[model samples]
Target: MTNIWEPIRIGRMNLPHRFAMAPLTRSRAQADGTPGELAAEYYGQRASLGLLISEGTQPSADGQGYPNTPGIYTDDHVRGWQRVTSAVHARGGHLFIQLMHAGRMGHPDNTAHGRAPVAPSAIAPGEKMFTLGGLKDAPVPRPLATEEVPATIADYRHAAARSIEAGADGVEIHGANGYLIQQFFSPNANTRTDSYGGSIENRARFGLEVVAAVVDEVGADRTGIRLSPGSRLGGIAEGEGHEAFYLHLVKELARFDLAYLHVAHGGNEELLRRIRELWPKALLVNRVNRPLEAATADVEAGLADVAPVGRWALSNPDFIERFRRGAALNPPDPQTFYGSGAAGYTDYPHLEASAASA
Candidate 1:
């Protein structure tokens, strides 16, 4: 039977195990959107996770939603990530940089741009966002002009090219978690009458355009996309008739023949089953908040090609080793989870250290 311990083939990359590290925002980047100095060390420490997916990296300045989140749009950003990719490669692990564009879930005070966020429509997420000034209500975003939507899609291509230049094994477009792509998918967040909104096909256009652009810049084998169906995050409402739209979106995305399809599961088992049937390639499933013992339940059931974990892998750098040894995992500290320093970032005890202390 397939399990997390087994090997898996994702796109052009052949991972030794089915253990993938899900993207977790560490918010430790420099003010200029470059990765922190310790970024390499932190990712390298967890290279044992097989596939290390980096945090939400903005494809453009306007794409940033939070302070100190890394960007992959600039040459400096490429250089900053090179160290991280090299570190992971040296440890025999592959790194996929996640390209995220936060739509209406931003405070101008949070991003260096100081401009209102952009989305398919000028709607607000109705959530308080952390910013440079402090916590503030998310502001209504500026609607992307019909003509400007293509340029926004191009931004993803540019970032994907830059990610490849940085020696990253691949790039995962952040289409999930109520980000730009998902914003376009949500009826509440995107109520535009343009060709980029309204109908499911039109709403799925922006996401497909961005994905196609990335696949064109970088090979399909080097591209992946994360999606969260029926996710109410960022005050998004997929609408009561949402299941059909999600299935249609997945069917359309499969035509690209891109890399894996990573789903941030939102308790829709039937929908996930449908998605698994529709997708022909790798399918990564993150059972949100599921315990360690059930991490690979989807994999064992042949529903997921990989089992991606967040907190478990975060607190235990030697995640696979500890699992093999049945060693107790160090509890993750909520305080340092999103900090600038290396307190809980890189200070998590490895299996050997824990064994020594014991």
Candidate 2:
């Protein structure tokens, strides 16, 4: 039986364990989109995980969705992330920076430039976004011109290059969570008539192109992508053929021979099984809020090569240790999940501290 603690090779990197730290947006970056000072400590504390997928980092200035989320496009952003990568690597950990483009999810007040969010179409998600003022309606984004699409893809390519330069093990294209890539996947969000829209192939084109561009810049072994099939977040409705579209997309992505396919399971067993069969490389399944035994069962049953956890990883920096010893976990405070501070970010007690206190 393959335990969660067993070492596994994903691409060129041999992870120490099978449990990876799923990207969680802590909103701890500076206003300029640079990572905060404590970002290194925050990530390094969880370095015991097999892999660390950093938060949804913007690929460009206009790609920012929420306030204080980090970016990898600028020199300052690169410098800020260098410290984080160094800290993780020093602890013998592998880090993958998630390249995310917010698309229509952006609020003018949230972004640094106050620019209108761009998307495949002009349709607004009809969702509210968090801003400095408070939660506000997301504005209808400006549609990208046919010529401008390439530039957007270039942004991802450049971001991938920057992440590598910052000493990251790889980059994971954030194609999930109703972001830019998912926006293209959603028929309701993307109603364009261009070559990049309409049919399933066309809708999957933008994401594939971005992946190809990143792979071109950084080899396939250092590239990965996250996908959330049939997700209804950010007011997106995939309509019919959601499963078929994702199956096709995964088949096409398989051609790249990328590092891993991180699937945020959205209650689709058939699609999940199909993806596992279609993808030739490593598979990381995110079963949100699932217990340790369930996650371990996923890997043991060959359903996933590894399982990524969110809240447990967030509240327990020594999650692997806790799981190994069956130690009691510190419950995460939902209020402090996203904010600028170390209260809930790094203050969670490890098993040693808990034992000493008791």
Q: Tally clashes: model 2.
A: 0
lDDT of each: 0.91, 0.92
Clashing pairs in 1: none
Task: Give the clashing pairs for model 2.
Answer: none
| Worst 10-residue lDDT window, candidate 1 | 104-113
In model 2, which range of ten residues has the least summed lDDT? Answer: 288-297
Question: How do the predictions measure up, each by TM-score?
Answer: 0.99, 0.98
Q: Write the per-residue lDDT of candidate 1 for residues 167-245, one digit (tens) a residue.
A: 9999999999889999998888888998988998998999999998999999999999999998988888897788999
Off-target runs (Cα >4 Å) in candidate 2 are none
